[model samples]
Target: MTLDPQTLLAILAMAVATAATRIGGLVLFGFLTLDRRQKRAMEAIPPAVLMAVVAPTALATGPAETIAAAITALAALRLPLLAATALGVAAVAALRAMGL
Candidate 1:
């Protein structure tokens, strides 16, 4: 039911390591020259990561949740990310309130 200090520390360490690895690559890349192939791959990285993040979150709950999240994201693109997130959360809350 609860995470002990040791387990929590390990989890934190892993998170930091993963972040460092990703950032370290970018830092190192700046000092070096990326070839054409690498550059092309890098261009695709953003969309790939977007999909990687979005696909799972969309499917995590259900179609309604996914639709709500999509609407929130779309709103965030036009408005502030916080406001969009609030809208998405509000949509979910309203659905729950309505007993949907």
Candidate 2:
């Protein structure tokens, strides 16, 4: 099936809007002078957002994968963040490879 011009334009518009929303926040936040409280609040945002995303994913995957992911998160907490991410991804990939 082929998308007509209008359908393609609509899809492109949606993509642009999503991109604008994401990048616009960075631009706006960068220019604005945030107070100390606001800065602290922003600092907490990432981990909260990460957990918001991972929580449902962890729940859906069940106890074992959740445990593995938790261990990965904890390890990442202890070591370099990138290494932890790589280790966690490798663990998940290996589990899938072995048909876990």
Candidate 3:
């Protein structure tokens, strides 16, 4: 499939925007010093963000997704975030394949 000039430009713009945001965040954070409370808050941010993004879909979707999310949460307790996410995805795929 061929991308038109406008589509190419839009893709480039998005790439630039994404890179700028990442670099901007790094630069902004590099100069800041975090205390104990701030560090704790930062530590909490990842799970909170994950929940914010996942909760609605998990709640609204079918049992497969919900069960997958539960497994992900349990795995999160013992595994790294990426591994837990992978587990959730795998669970959902397996459940769906079984016609759940």
Candidate of highest TM-score: 3
Candidate 2 deviant stretches above 4 angstroms: 4-7, 35-40, 75-84, 94-100
lDDT of 1 by residue, 30-95 (tens): 898889998877765554555457668776977667777677657755665567667878986776
lDDT of 2 by residue, 1-100 (tens): 8879999999999999999999999899888998999897776565456556776887688555676577666765566555766777777777766666
Per-candidate Cα lDDT values, in order, are 0.73, 0.73, 0.87
Predicted structure 2: clash tally: 0
Worst 10 residues of 3 by lDDT: 43-52
User: 1-100 in candidate 3: lDDT tens per residue?
Assistant: 8879999999999999999998998899899999999997776667667867997999798999888988888887777778888999999999999988
Residue 24 in model 2: lDDT: 97
Give candidate 1's whole-model lDDT.
Answer: 0.73
2 against 3, candidate with superior TM-score: 3
RMSD of 3: 2.4
